[model samples]
Target: MKSPGLTLVSYGGKRYRFDAGALCTELLTTGGPGEFARYESLHEPADLLRWVERSRLPSGLEMPVSEGELAETRALRNALFQVVADRAHGRPLAARELAAVNLAAAGAPLAARIEADGSRGWAPGATVARLLATVAREAVELLTGPYADRFRECGSGNCGLLFVDTSRPGRRRWCAMEHCGNVHKVRAHRARRAEGDD
Candidate 1:
């Protein structure tokens, strides 16, 4: 069953569940740089709104998104991709990518409010600026926080998804055990059998 923060992705007609483990990493799925651009889903403003709804952030936020924000969002996402890939591979942080993330995070994030029913809600005046800021801020935190060393690219050699390992042992290796992990296990088993080692 689908849970909050988990998004289903279709790869060449095969559907798989993906949990990016952090709000920022989740945005990487919408689109990315170079070859990843083929997966672009933010060609229109409505697309960004849809992404917000699907994001790990709680629902009930209404905001207006402009064409410029849409463009900015794509740029932020692209920068984030490089930042994450670099970090995951133990490389030095790229100054340009770090600057883009910091620039967006400088904007005001979405404010929080307590509802009459004792539930959490967003404060008034939500906007795409706040949404992007929230995402960028989270990226900043994830990159510098306790789990900074825990963030990793998917273990599948060909999978480009990134995730932070929040589990107690921090042994997470795949984007989702039900997806990449299983595939790896099956492939390994077949290889063993083919070699008469099974």
Candidate 2:
């Protein structure tokens, strides 16, 4: 009954709690054990572990999964995760990624409108590369916009977890009320009781 975060949608509807820090590990498709391990070692193990705990991957696909393949795939996912992270942080896109997009936008914007009152015509897909570039642009927008707003970091005591705010008021607190939220409340109550006893 629980909802998943944006990163977990990578498996194409096969939901699972995917650790964001280990994104590269989940996405790299063609690599050996040493390579995968080195990639995973880039981040702090504890942080990645915490992210893994909060991540959720969907189920239902009949995947021919293997340990080796999973590692490679995770690495590939990592690459995508980095891109989203960079975009969120307002960093420039990598050189290779931007070259073609820049070239196309140079001549004419990818998605544009004519003023009709005498303006230049819009030619978005002037080339194949530009069309595919448009698709990638839209994908990133969808993720950081709707998806980012939907799932936010918990307001609890820095638990390093994120949850989907599916409440009617769109103000759900903590990753789960039965877990982190309840624990925090109980701790606060105990502290108050100790003060009263004193």
Following a full C-alpha superposition, what root-mean-square deviation does model 1 have from the true structure? 2.0
Which consecutive 10 residues in model 2 have the weakest lDDT in total?
22-31
All candidates' TM-scores?
0.93, 0.39
Q: All models: lDDT?
A: 0.87, 0.40
- Model 2, span 1-198: residue lDDT tens: 124442332214533332222222232221223333443432433332333334332221122334443333344334444444345445665654344333333442144455566543434334323322343344344444654454444456554343334466776666456555776899999999999999
Off by over 4 Å in 2: 1-60, 66-68, 76-142
Cα displacement (Å) at residue 82, model 2: 6.4
Give the per-residue lDDT of model 1 (tens digit) for 138-183. 9999889998998899999988888778888999999888788998
RMSD of each: 2.0, 13.2
Number of backbone collisions per candidate: 0, 29
